[model samples]
Target: MKKIYFFLTLVFTGIQVQAQKDFQGMAVYESKTQAPKFEGMRANRDITPEMQKNMEERMKQMLEKTFILNFDKSSSIYKEEEKLDAPGQQGGMRIMMNSFMGGGGTFYKDVKAKTYTVDKEFMGKEFLVVDSLPKLNWKLEQETKQIGGYTCYKATAVKEASKTDFRNLRPKNNDDKKPEDKKEDPKKTSGETKTNFQDNFELPKEIVITAWYSPEIPINQGPENYWGLPGLILEVNDGRTTILCSKIVLNAKDKATIKAPTKGKVISQKDYDETVIKKMEEFREMNRGRDGGPVMIRR
Candidate 1:
């Protein structure tokens, strides 16, 4: 009897090891952002009822989005699912509006290497941004909850807001001329020269991020750049944005393709940010005297 029991124990251990080794799967997440209220316009009596309704609808469309994470033990690929335009919104106006409100690109993370890569498109040009993974000082708590049928533990961290988070306000410019060349142009005036509005516009310095992770999955991955946890993150709330996992497939028979995106100009994250800020300044310069255009004011 003892010998039989020992043999059975060994067999069960082997099975458990195999199960842990084959823990590759995919997770689907739905994210929602709280719509901003144009309080200034409302207080000044500049917002009409029809304009308010349109703003609400547009904000809803921009804030609600879906993403998929295809991950294994040490690496993952997170990308936004492509969404079709609304019916009857195939006109040039729709395209122009969408150009201002863009989504993030494919993000790849390698936990072992401590690196991340993002494929982003600004204006019409593509760029591949490579950078180190964000080092979040997460405070793991004893608090727990259930998400998507998995028991999750709570963790919180504080991080600086990323530049990509403000993509809507920083629309890209397609001009090929350099900044110095643009200044020397005879048609350009001092009043129309580029101004760094971002300097005056203060974004939140630190965002409080909350995440719920499931140890059952045993993978250090999550939607977007949130990672470095002992388990799979099932839900994340970063004040303005919330990402919740709707479904998780473990050891799926049909494995997902987890590959890095390879299309765009290769650049570091710092360089890309500088390029974007400069372009946004140029865009402001180009539209300095424009009247009747959309005005975006953040309070």
Candidate 2:
């Protein structure tokens, strides 16, 4: 009860302070995902421990990333910070991660308008995905914590897992279930959702997101596709991954001007996802060897 009262007082003071200023803030975030483990492959003697270690290291380097969020009162732009790949080594893993995870380009959201426009680069083509901001039914919890010197409160929501993102993604291995799910799989002994070739595939129906937000910031903005909180979400844990704000510049001298992308074919998010799936299927066919394999399917 005391925490709630203090939080509300901060929010009121924040609104007053914000109203007097041209309020723009920049926040730096560290994002990381739990790379799916291949239990079946680990059990195989042919796959060495060294090979597994190397693979894990590669994924860690790719999945662990930095992002910047620039925001005002009711609008924000979230994007990955620029980083150089090793010389002559095109970031294949990073590129695939971007395309497969529906990441890349700027993610701009307008809270007042209830709209969001995002850019997606996939398979040598760019797409401008224009869609209404997803409405999340956020349930505010009384629990509070501190993040980067700011008091933060906990809130949770159950979102319909997006098919466009990596979380709900699973390769359709010529069947509704994964290779390990079928009895015909040579390596299958148990019904665990694990495959040797497909280390990253899980079909979760919903995404439960727990966010820690600070009301002192006083903005309905969050990292990535999450928003509509009473404050700026400083940390988000969506089961398989977590995004945490490391630093914040409330009002910097050189503010980033938020702008929507002008390039690429304008399409709704649904159509863009369908396009991605269709292109992926075609790509799979072209590269299909005698030892045929898996492709993505729509939810």
Question: Highest lDDT, which number?
Answer: 2
lDDT of candidate 1 over 32-147, digit per residue (tens): 87644332222225678787777677667767778989998888999878778777544444433333433467899999899998888777788898999988999999999899
TM-scores vs. true structure, each candidate: 0.75, 0.79
Candidate 1, poorest ten consecutive residues by summed lDDT: 191-200
lDDT of each: 0.74, 0.78
Residue pairs with clashing backbones, model 2: none
Superposed Cα deviation of residue 174, candidate 1 (Å): 34
Instruction: Give each model's clash number.
Output: 0, 0
Candidate No. with top TM-score: 2
RMSD to native, candidate 2: 8.0
